[model samples]
Target chain A: MSRKRSRNIFIATCITPAIMLFALFMVVPTFEVFRMSLYNWGGLSGNKTFIGFNNFKVLWNDMRFIQSFQNSVLLIVLVAVLTIVVAIFFASVLTKEKVFATNFFRIVFYIPNILSVVIIAGIFSAVYNPRTGLLNSILGLLNLEQLQRQWLGNQDIVIYSLAGALVWQAIGYYMVMYMSGMASIPESYYEAASLEGAGKFKQFSAITLPLIWNNLRTTLTFYIISTINLSFLLVTAMTGGGPDGSTEVFLSYMYSQAYSNSTYGYGMAIGVVVFTFSFVLAAVVSRITKREVLEF
Target chain B: MKETKRINTDTLYKVFIYVALITLAITIIIPVAWVFMASIKENQEFYGNPWALPQGIHFENFREAFVEAGMGDYFLNSIIVTSLALVFLLVLALPAAYVLSRFEFVGSKFINGFIKAGLFINVSYITVPIFLMLLGWDQSLRQIFDSGFFLNNLSVLALIYAVTALPFTIFLLSSYFETLPSDFEEAANIDGAGYFRTMFSIMLPMAKPSIIIVILFNFLLFWNEYILALTLIPGDKKTLPVGLLNLLAADRAAVNYGPMYAGMVIVMLPTLILYIIVQKRLTQGMTVGGVKG
Candidate 1:
């Protein structure tokens, strides 16, 4: 065979399987998500009608959908804020201070990340069980029985309960991420700051924070996307959007509408909105948090 | 006097840091250790105080979870699916990543762009559509073959897992591939190694660190994955996580809490063991490719 011909064959042989599988599974279905949204398709039936934007029209009025949207936004904000704060603090301390058994803490922190969301759901179910739960029992032991309440049962507190689980799962991953970024900052900068009589907080604010601002901004986008995705996964396992849809998040509701309810088109519509929402949110966040790249 | 006062506050700050760290640590440790303790606890021990230690080691819960709840079968299913998906993923991703990173072909940039776009397509979004598509294909197959094959098949599920995982796998592998100098390929060519020979013998072996990282990361992902497993396999055949989910639901309704926690342990123990073994590599490799689904 000619070299050029063989080269063409090699490339073809190398790329075809991956691209074909990807095109079949990933690309086509993603397009189907967009295409199916335009149809009024019911489950397992040949009753798909071309209903343009009408599914979305109904979605606007869906109180359950609205509730899910609220829950999702609430989760995104809460998980992102809580995880980022705690992760950054721990990341800073672990990287900077001389803490005892830092490796042990890091290892333990990441345990939640490795376990399945289903496991987390089970763990929290135990932790949140109203009668014999760890939380309530602990509160009782601490002589704070008044603080004991339904951790997952009450509609008012369930979303926060879910958020707490998510934040727990997320902090370790993000902390590791931030720690890597923080670890890369030159130590000389910190030494100079300390030499100039700058306290630890000032050194963090001046040297570490500004230096890792770009990393933080990037993770903010990650926080948004993963939080949206994970909230759905957790809700599916934990609550199944329980207590009259109080804990329903975006994808969980979409899963119910599409998969369970067999309202395929409606579910796809929710997917469309979520996809666009995440993209726009990430873009806006990236823009607002954009700072000139710091050179250290 | 000044130095003593300064040291006092400094010591206090250190103590405060320790307290904060220990507080967070306990919050994490207690719940997980609680699960482990609960897993071995007898059914009656779950009644009074969750904080109470198990009166005795109740191995029955694990047996029930393993045999009765079908977690044993699901554990096998998870192992099969995870390993198959990793195999399929590496086979597909490695060559594509190598060619894309090294070779300049027609539409390579566009293919790269396409894969980049695929990164944004989260599995949750297209899961229903994928299910529907497979269901449609199954409907067609049933017309001829008299049975459905697409849904509920482990290999097909594994394939889909690999396909959905392609973009990230490709992205991570290609980034690693792009770092290699052209001299290796040229040397291979001088040694009469053709493209496939070069990739197999030279380039691929060189990508071992990356390959290991990919396997480690995707093993956890595929093992822990349930949403796709739950949606795709809407049958008795289930992965561990889905089985655990069912156990959670069943045990909740039946109030058989022992088996439920046992199921949780069954599902998570492998990942935990794996994490403990390669945690340093896992966390270090995580920075190489940031976001995972």
Candidate 2:
């Protein structure tokens, strides 16, 4: 009995510090943010007026907030679809033994995955810098100067450019996921399909796709969450929610409001909105993708 | 038995596969090659012959990036923050994961779910609030530790990274510990080893692979992290990402692409090398962990 008590104590002691830290740092602050959303605070001042949802009311009516939310949604859709499609395509191609220099190709592609967003943003900025950018320079050499346009500064095409950069960064990660899924597929399934005269394409369609449905679903979930979360860094570096807020996503806009604009209450309200949106998105994805476990 | 026709068709398919794969490889390599070429070229050469190889290898850009841009400090800061955070994450997460995985107790499910739910809270969503909290702490704590406590900025950033890494670390380690046989632990317990002893002496050594995975994941995540570090750490203690941003701002008008590219090359090399070294383990680890979810 004494031994069991000591064991329990040890476990409790081991977990307490972490739990405390997490509670203090993550949970408490999260709740505080929620509470602060109800007030009109200027930040760093004692003059926090009790607004009671006025900030949220402002948030609801704010055009920038609404547009950023839409942009966030659009970004999530574009990045998620592109990443999955590109990843699966690469995964399928790389799995074949006949594919020459598979390891070399894998290494080349994975380079972008490991790069910091700052570096990627820098690289793309150089490549897209209107005057001497590689793209414009190439077009100039081809005597197609009229075709060249400002990639980052151009409001209309900026979002697509940002998406392109994101896809470039993210595709390698999803490819790793898909390749692993493909690797786990049983060889016997392929053998059976081959015996029945199923070609590679048909086999992939019927066998591999269905088999890796779980991975696909998980990748989709990761894509959505990360797209919403991490893409802010790229957006900040590349555009700064710029060319008149055309590329503003929720996170960047919230950042500007809080740090730059000093609209603390409004920023907290946006945070709440972001939290609620993410929670709903996650719950919905999980529900839609939920399936009974496949016994292999 | 009709195997001859099958062989011929297989050969044809092989040719088609190679063609498709080479195209994919070219697409992947082109951008990287472009960056490498630009990094070595002069600004004039870049504009004049963008696609051509550099007229001369300009290795001085690397020096300028390190010394002039103060990327040396940034690199050191990144290393310190990432390493410290990784250590803290592993230390806290391992035991927590162990407890949650090995023992079923009151609130265990809730605790596990709580930690896992953190994965959904998009780090960006919490960044503002967390930054405000840190700012408050910094202001208060500054009086207690004097100016020396400024180094605690790294600790604060590390704490955040460690917390953020908790969900994935716990989730991965729990699955790993679940797969470990209970018999070894039971035997150790029967032989007068306390739970801590059994866990450390028996289970930990066995769980080395999972530990490595945890370390690698935490390392990569913290290393690449920008927003958290940017918000938390002020000037003079800037990490690589923030340093790069500063460099960009300082050079935006001058348009010196050479040193900027060199800085990028420096920042990217560590992660690129680490990725290559651990590519196999990373692929397998993420696949197993990801699929389980």
Candidate 3:
């Protein structure tokens, strides 16, 4: 029952497996990726030659890498903004007592959130199918045929199409988050505001939004991380960064370079850059939203 | 002014709100509906007008997708890997989470932060190094077992799945355990229950709901996972999602689009069923975890 003995027991019973497995699987491999990024390793069965920053310098000159980076940034911003707006709007309605079928609609909206990304990606690509697809067909049927564009093919619109699909899947989860945040807000405030002749929009801006500000902050962080990764998944499944890499995002391009081309060092270099890029973005987001804009 | 506002513009605004909500609902519903309706149609119907209703229910398309396209094998493999990974992830994450939540130590905060950092490091970012690592492990593993063993070389994928699921599961579970009262631990302590004994005997059962939530979330994620499986795990031994991608990528011209859609439906079936069963818990769990600091 000695204190030090108990401490040793705590360490033994608790920390070892978690730290050990994480360090072995996660930490070491992460370090190895960094080291390999410094070398010209050609993946498995390939030789390694340490070449400092060569891959990075080459990445700078690579237009595809730059384009993919642009695509990732675009997705991050678009998904965050669109999901927040849609979520807040939907959440406001659902949280009201008079909104009939609120729970039913909430669950209905969440249907896409619970489904797998691969399947959703398939569903979306089919929706964008050029000939008999839902989008183009609807456009054609409505006599708006001239406005229909090749949703996934026309390089100009492909990234936006991908972003739209992401926003569709993402909004429900955020909506629910906003719902939870709004649930915690006191009803008296809204009632008082209503009696003061405030309208629904006025009540939302004056009351619900400020109350859920912290929740929104957390949602923003979640958005930054998941949106970037989700972009990678969508591109891999739907386009494989295709139509001549028009839809390429950061991770898909890295995946192709490493897995497809077996340019291990180059791909690892991209990985390092992506890791750093995400880390900085997350830090910036957390910092920017750290100050509470409104206090209840 | 209040009476006038209530009579006209307020009603107009309420109608606008209702229309917007219904529009958003359609956007979410139509895609899944399209997939379901397409699954029942023959290729001719699908190709003719995908938006149109199916002429007759066709189970044959599902049969073709399950048998001819090798979806059954891929589905089984995905199940095995996702389940095995969840087990290992739980075994590894729970004890750490329990200790971090209940006990004090010098590096507890550091450890918590360290593991949470995994979220920032996307698996795609580190896939090359991890792939090489698995490939090396497979080399040694193959020598120990016969070369013809089906999943012998593929076991490393389950491990990777566990690692990817680790950060969030641990983060969620530790916080969940934190919300439980300390009296449970003191009660165990007074009864002479050791740390491991206390966790398995009490905390595991007590924290079961959160654990289930974490498991379901991770299961959905691993089941849907593709790029890692595509990169690290090679060949026809791949999981369901990558398998579907391969089917798509092979040749669209030669593909039977009907069966392909069926395969997509088959792939989506498990998650939809699980969501239906645990619909309430999924929303609550995700929202709670989502807003966690």
Candidate 4:
């Protein structure tokens, strides 16, 4: 065989398994998810009993599904905004030369991001535990008992409490991201802004925010996705979407229906909704955030 | 007078920034310390004083978590699944990345774009179908082997983990490969290196650092994975996160707070140690993927 012919064959040989595996696991199964969403099957077994979008229609009127969808969007917004704000604040500070132990602080901040969701949930639950939990105990110790309340059990505040945990876990990762973003900017921009008599706040809005706009937009997209999906693990761990379903999220709702409640078709329908909603949200956020890059 | 006022303002701003940063830092650090303290405390001590120092070392908590609460089993299960799955992912991604980056072929761009689209696929959205597919695998495996029930679950779990990881893996590594100079491949080809030999000897070795980064990304991913492991892997074969949940959920009846905390510690320690050790590389790998994506 010609060397070129053999080389082409070699490339094909090298490439086929990945394509096959990718198709089997991702492409084929994704198509399967959409197809199955139209049926009324219990699971893999028994008759599928085609219902043709009945599952989607039920999801439309499903209160639990609707509530969970709202909760997910709420989480996406809260986590995206809070994490970005906190991360930017810390990253901006750490990027400045005046900050002490930036390395130490950076590593410390990212620590929670590295830890398991289960562990973070454990810590959060302990803090939120009503009777002798840390938050209540600390409030009691400070003689501020009136401020203390059931953190996880109160339906009104439960999602917020869970969002707090998610933000806490996420800040470090986003901080590192913003840190990298800040690192790439020319230091001269900050110096010029300062020389122009722009104060700290003004310099941040002018120099820091504008330069980091690209990273911020990307981070916003990431935040939307993570807040929606990452909440699955955290919600499962901390509240299991509990205290009267206040914390129910798209994934947990789907999880319970598919596995716990054995309505795989309904669950798959919810999955399609979640998949569509988040992508649209991400696209909208990213588009709205798009701006002319301030090349330094 | 203006300069002095400016200096004072600068100091004030610094103080405000430091104070805000310090307070937030404490918020992150204290909870972890509390978990560690709780792990070593006696059950009553934990209930009585959540923040108190353990009266003694309580070396038994680790043992209790490992042996009694059976975190050891879950740890073993996670280690086996994550490591094997990472190996599987690398095996799939390396050559695919190599081909996509190097060879010109019809439909390659389409394939490459398809892989990129997979990045946006939230695996949870498709969990129902994926779960059913695993059930199908189980049925087929049982009928064929007439035994080895957990085999399909384990195999399917590994595949799922690898597949979920593929988009990022291929994207990152293909970019890495694209950045490489053609000199090495050209040199090997001129030296009469066969195709497989050239890829294995020259290209693969050169891609080592990128490969390591891919492995770290997938390793961290599979280690902390919860949802799939929760759905697919059954009772005793639960991965660490899922197993920790099971342990904590059952702890109400068990009332074994010390061991429960220890299990939490156990679940977190590997990734913690890993982050500390390869702190730079871990952050770089994850951020590279993040920033690039």
Summarize candidate 3's per-residue lDDT along B49-164 as a digit string, tens digits: 77779899988888887788888898888988888888888888888888887777778788878988875566666666776776776677678873533223356778777877
Per model, kept true contacts as a fraction are 0.89, 0.61, 0.67, 0.74
Candidate number of the best lDDT? 1
Q: In candidate 1, which residue ranges exceed 4 Å CA deviation?
A: none
Query: Which 10-residue window of candidate 4 chain B scores lowest in summed lDDT?
Result: B147-156
TM-score of 2: 0.91
**Cα error, candidate 3, residue B287 (Å):** 2.2
Descending-lDDT candidate ranking: 1, 4, 3, 2
Q: Which portion of correct inter-chain contacts appears in model 2? A: 0.61
lDDT (Cα, tens digit) per residue for candidate 1, span A193-274: 8899998889989999999998899898888889889999999999999988999999999999999999889899999999
Residue-level lDDT for A133 in candidate 4: 89
Measured against the true structure, the TM-scores of the candidates, in listed sequence, are 0.99, 0.91, 0.93, 0.96
Task: Report the C-alpha lDDT of model 3 over A71-154, residue by residue, as the tens digit.
Answer: 999989998998899888888888874786887798888888776677878888788988888999989989999988889889
- Interface RMSD for candidate number 1? 0.8
Better of 1 and 2 by lDDT: 1
Candidate models: Cα lDDT each: 0.91, 0.79, 0.81, 0.83
lDDT of 4 by residue, A1-296 (tens): 89888978888888888888788878887898788788787844546779998898888888998899899888888988888888899988898758887788888888987777788889988888998688899899999999898999899888888899989989888888888888888888888888898878898888889988998888887887888777987888878888788899998998888778887777778888888887888898888889999887
In terms of TM-score, which candidate is stronger, 2 or 3?
A: 3
Candidate 3, DockQ score (0 to 1):
0.59
Clashes of each: 0, 0, 0, 0
Model 1: per-residue Cα lDDT at residue B90? 92
lDDT of 4 by residue, B163-280 (tens): 7888888999998999999999889889999889988888899988888888876777789888778877655677788878877888755777888888888888888888888888
Worst 10 residues of 4 chain A by lDDT: A39-48
